[model samples]
Target: MATITSAGAGSGIDLESVISASVAAKKTQLQQPITTKKTNTQITLTGVGQLKSAISTFNTTLAKLSTAGAFNKRAINITQDSDDPILKISSNTDASNGQYNVTVNKLATTSKVEGTFASSTSSLITEDGTLTITAGDGNEFTVDVKKGDTLQQIRKRINNASDNFGLTANIVNTSDGKAKLVIDSGVTGAGNDLKISGSTTELKMFEADTSSATPVTGSSMSRTQQSTNAEIDVDGNILTSDTNTFKDKVQGLDITVLRVSDKDSDGNLKSNKVDITTDKSAIKTLVQEFVSAYNTLIDKSTELGKRNTIVGGESQDDGGALAGDSMPRSIRTLMANTVMEPNSEMTGINSIFQLGIKMDNDGKLSVDTDKFDDALDDNYEQVVALFSGENGVAGKLQTSLKEYTKTGGLISQRQDQLNSDLRDLSSREATAADQLEKYEANLRAQYGSLDTLLAQMQSSASYLSLLSTS
Candidate 1:
């Protein structure tokens, strides 16, 4: 008789465990959404993008705070005194003669003259015979006088040479039918003393007739120095300097420096302040940028809350409010509270809301243009304090945001934890798979041996039954 006895199946090879393990691994991969290899890259990119956007918003706000018409502290302007008239000779006019002198009480430490002059004779005459004339001394005079020049020719010569000398020369005909040559010194100083001593006598008519038997008594022209630079009060302080660097003399102002004499291109003896007006357009642009950035953040938060992206969703797709949100509710809460809160350290600035900026229904920032302008007009310092003062909104926001994104911050710590978890999970999955595969192979061998034994027993039983029946 053939009997069937139970041989242990040895737990049936637990195929379900292998399948469950595979399913669990797939589920784990899906649940994590980001792998160890890609998590850093995605998070880094997202964090950088958010940081850049925040910086852009901050910059926009800062730009709005800067007033366009604020006077450039470096600017300066130099204007000549209107009350005190400056003496300038008309064209075609010359000094009483080729020899004329002027005197003034106040003297400019640095003085210069540039003009042209002509004389009847070519003989060079120094303004002060005692003072040696040197090139570029502002005192050297060039006399363009040709030989055999007439009285009228002498007048023309002085006019022609007016550029070389600061003085002018002209011949005035008296009622006695005699012409007297006159010279007028263009500048006032001891250096203005004119002397004519050369081989040419044509210019002698303009000199003092000291040799006449009867000494002609007239106001003997003498040279005197005078202050040529204008004085001005700057920042409640009295400062003196050359006209060229007058702008530098001022404490704070932007000025265009100009030369006093037309001959010297390098000489800057005057300065003109440039006109600066408030740039309303720039302010408007800044406001728009801020609004746009704020709106973008709000929109991004909304999208993240609705969708199950790594950055926030609910149920299977619901990453939960915090799960997939790019701009988390916590961050929004921080931003809102920081911008709205008042700081005890800041005296005038209480809140950004005081500056006429408010959030709309869409959770985007908006500015009341007129009210904002009024607030700015009222107290710009208070506005600055509100956003940028000690422990202020902007400062707090920056600190909080940086804490979340900076190295060793929340994001970095989370990433490190995730990476470690992934490593452990990967090792566990590999070990489970290896153990399962070995178990399956051993079960297959056992099943093959049992099948061989069962087949032999069946064959022997069948043969024995047939022989007995026969």
Candidate 2:
């Protein structure tokens, strides 16, 4: 089609239109098939991706149902008898169903000791000495006192020590310019008491050691609080804890003693009753959600693989891209079979339907919430067993769906093959286009040469006829 000396000018023939029509016919013959294949490939890929996404979302919904915690969860209720709750309580899924009467007799304490000083800033350290403090859990820290160190300065040094164990030191200055060094231990329990000792006698006057017989001596130091364990009475059984929280006292229940229970007129410690039971409502809600998700997946698969509808004598609806594909059909059949099949191993409630998961005629799921709740009230364990074990409904569905949706899965591999075909078609189309360009150019060149030959022959015939006439 490039402008050459007009191909039919000398020969008086319209060769340009002929060449154009021939090239058009050749292009249709060579490239139309590739164009059709590429369009179909793109359509199928889009449909498959949408279907995979739907299956993945449904799988996520099944995750909660496959776990034992979803069914075995425990909710607790405690009687608030006193204005101040004696204990703060909670239970996990592992907690047994039972009732517990709990009473907090005595709570744990941390050691608090204070030392008196005649003046807030009086020089206490006459010579170089070391003040050492020790406790359980490898808590041993020392503060080196230099000469002419005041009581307030020593208190600041203890507070600022980087390696100082769990304790705080404060100088509480009295009204008459006298001061007191108060040290409160954060290390809890009786055996884990804080002990302080100084190398010199004058510094020893400020000593306070809970591990020793005389924890505080002289007029300088006094013990305000002693370290003790938390004690509680539960159903005639006494329990002790190093901290305020008494963990596992009621078999998977953590009871943190807030304060001692109020005493009655007869001096009997008031008690609160705790009830632990299976959380049926939460589990039932999870089952209902799973059914909803299951129905959604079925609906999506049907829409994706739907066939054309014929109204009267004409096709009124165009078929889906995946209308003839077995991938979507197989997925729907697998999930539907898994749902409809009754459990052979489980007794009484052998299937999801017994748990009120009803299937429609068109293969969709519906939840009867009341029936499911009633089943939970009567046969909760059987319902849990139907959905949680290795052969459970959710478990089997996940296993089956994994084949189609996992990395390099069946559908993914199919998509990969289709993309490979599309690339091949693209390469072929480019090569064919290049060859056709050359072909068209060659045809124009040959026809232009023929036109010049015909023009030369006409000139020769005209001269020959003139010679004959002469």
Candidate 3:
């Protein structure tokens, strides 16, 4: 029947409502299923991407503890018997756990000397000449004294010279109406003493001779301190250093001597006990981190695969986004297998089980702290091997996880298929819409002709009735 858009249809039927209802039914029949399919496909695709991202995050934990260097963290503790403040110590991984008694005998001293002049502002040098300052270490600098340069002026010249090695000059005005020009070597060591000599008689009074144990005769300056090597007795073995700092003197220990230890009643040097021990806490923390990361992967994956649930006594029909997906299940299985396969070859730690990390039926991990501590205490290296070695848990997971996570892997392929389904559904929805449009058009066209036919039949009957009456 035709739909009567105008009010003149004799059929007396509201065909416009009929045509609209028919079109609505066709659209529902043709397009609803495709729309549902697209929605489900998008959910599945999103679920797969989440799974891949979770796996990638877990891989970071694997990468962190995958090296021997990560196991090289050191914990050094020093305990001293005396509070002499003699040594500041540090050690690296190469240091062994042992006790050493170090008695600092003498700290290295710098050579210093002083030359007295007439007054604080006197022209110490009356004529020009060269004053050569040399260190026993072969560093030297020469200064030219003008005819009337004050003692303070000469001090500035000596200090300002770039090649002055490690020498420092200061002028101290004494209470006896005379000025003292004090020059000291900045370097410390037995043979690095300072020697100041002049080329002319006028500058000779400013000369310093600290080269020998006693200042040489005719040297106008008085020796204040002598350069000496730093001496230490480590467990009855004497060790001497040019400077105060001794690096690797006892394997990985670096020591800087600050002062000589005080002697006891019998003139015996006091000793400071150096304590070195392994830090077992770092390894334990690392193991705990591994447990947490593995459990996270398990927990997230399990959540993704959850089935339908009942909410407020009403059954929520659909499950999680990744429900019933075989690829995620297979991915979980692959990881579970890698976490246990091909046991480690390291001594004592044959597997992760020995290190107190265990997996449950749900693929979640938990640690036994007492057992873990015992393992770390007994065999630290083996514990490192079980987690980070060539055939270890992390190692195997790293190799197996790539099969699903890499470009064109199982996860990628599944996502690709889901996306293709979505694209296909879009095309199907468009086709269904086009078909519904044509069906509505056909109904409207056919129903309009029926209305016209019905109106003509009514008119013929009315004309027939009038003729009979006449």
Which one is best on TM-score?
2
Q: What residue pairs are clashing in model 3?
A: 1-447, 2-447, 2-448, 166-186
Better of 2 and 3 by lDDT: 2
Which parts of model 1 are misplaced by more than 4 Å?
1-273, 305-327, 343-349, 389-392, 454-470
Candidate that scores best on lDDT: 2
Off by over 4 Å in 3: 1-12, 80-274, 309-315, 342-344, 455-470
lDDT of 1 by residue, 1-470 (tens): 22212222322334445545665665465434335434544554454355445544554453433333221111111233334422121111110112111111122332222212243234434332221112223645545545545556645655565354555556556666555555554443333334432333433323332112232233222222222443333333444433323443322322222222222267532232223233344444555565566567556555444545444333455443334445456666666666667776756646667777888765678888888778666765565455442354545656666666667876567567656666766766566566656554555455546655666777798899999999
lDDT of each: 0.45, 0.82, 0.79
Q: RMSD of candidate 2 to the true fold?
A: 5.6
Better of 1 and 2 by lDDT: 2
Model 1: weakest 10-residue lDDT segment is 91-100
Looking at model 1, residue 337 earns an lDDT score of 67
Per-residue C-alpha lDDT of model 2 across residues 1-470, encoded as one tens digit per residue: 45464678887889888888888988888888878888888888899999989999988877766865556767778887556667777776568789888888889988878876788777877798888877667888898888999987898888888898767889888888788889887877879877788888777776886665455665367778778899988888999998999888677788998888878899988888888888877776777778788889988898889888888989866877787788878988999899778888976779888877788788888888888889888997788888875678988898889888999999899889988988998998898899888778887898888888988999899999999999
| Candidate 2 lowest-lDDT run of ten | 211-220
User: lDDT by residue for model 3 over 352-425, one digit each (tens)?
Assistant: 78778788888888888999889888887777677775466786787788777889987889888888888888
Write down the TM-score of every candidate.
0.44, 0.75, 0.61
